[model samples]
Target: MQLNISRGPKATGKTVRLRQTAMKAGIKEKNILIGTSYPDRELEAKVLQLALRGLKVICIDECREEQLAFLRRVKDLICNSVTVHVVVAN
Candidate 1:
């Protein structure tokens, strides 16, 4: 698993940079999963499931603190060598 972080104030180019990284990684669009970092079980589960299904890149934009904690609890369980995690936050 690889982790890339984009942290800055709002209106910064964090999202753009992460997206560019994902694009440049040469993965297919369907192999790239974009999601939000809120405390939603369905959303969180989808992120993990798709990663397990072989997504090459994962993007979590605007992560909330609680959601970050939740993800941290399960990141190891879902992390794979071929996957890249791009985490964007303020």
Candidate 2:
């Protein structure tokens, strides 16, 4: 399980970098799980997840500094099978 953290200001293309990293890790678009703070976006991610199988490439966007613990928990939960990448826009 690999964990990559991409931190930068808004519009810095963090998400783009994350996608590239996931691809490099051999995870396809169909097997990616993207999570955000927004409820609607999360719903969309859930829908996307339903179409995939096996370990996922979990990308959490807009993560805040204080949410490191939460992110760690998520990482631990799927550490065995997934690669967790976090993107924080400061």
Candidate 3:
């Protein structure tokens, strides 16, 4: 699997970059799952769950350390063909 980690200060257009990458990769919006630690945790978890189901692309924004750990634990769930984009905005 391809893993991309985007790190930068807040409001650096991380989400926009991820979206562009996803589009370039030909992953449909429905097949793309976005997980954000801000605003809501439950919603992020739900989105991550969908990503574990072999979604085309998975983007995690403002990710926490624990969330990174969770990704490691579920790494096997992501297929080799899938690409994961992680955006960490400070």
Candidate 4:
């Protein structure tokens, strides 16, 4: 249930940075969810689905500040089983 944030300007390698952090954290590449866009309801569902299926790190790129509540929601629902790594543009 750890929360991590990669914050920088757009095109500043936040996604790559998060992946590196995930690698350092010992989470497998296959177990990491590399988010490609902002969260919608469909993607939100996928997040929870992956969390339930052993997704260790969630790196949501291009995140808006408001989207953090959504991340926290998923973290709470996952109940300390998964780690959340969020990417936010400055």
Instruction: Give the candidate number with the greatest lDDT.
Output: 4
Tens digits of per-residue lDDT, candidate 4, 1-90, equal 566877866787777887787788776666555454535555567778867888676656566666666666666677575777777656
TM-score head-to-head 3 vs 4, winner: 4
Better of 1 and 2 by lDDT: 1
lDDT of 3 by residue, 69-88 (tens): 56665567556676678776
Q: What is the lDDT for 8 in model 3?
A: 79
TM-score per candidate: 0.68, 0.53, 0.60, 0.65
What lDDT would each prediction earn against the true structure? 0.61, 0.58, 0.63, 0.68
Off by over 4 Å in 1: 27-39, 82-84, 87-89
lDDT of 4 at 53: 80
RMSD of each: 3.0, 5.0, 3.8, 3.1
By descending TM-score, how would the candidates be arranged? Answer: 1, 4, 3, 2
Per-residue alpha-carbon lDDT of candidate 2 for residues 8-65, written as tens digits (9 for 90 to 100): 7788788788778768877676544544454544433443353245545666566665
**Backbone clash pairs in model 2 (N, Cα, C under 3 Å; residues 3+ apart or in different chains), count:** 0
lDDT of 1 by residue, 24-59 (tens): 876545544554524556556766776788876676
Candidate 1 TM-score, true structure as reference? 0.68
Off by over 4 Å in 4: 10-13, 24-39
User: In model 1, what are the clashing residue pairs, if there are any?
Assistant: none
- Candidate 2 Cα outliers beyond 4 Å, as residue runs: 22-53
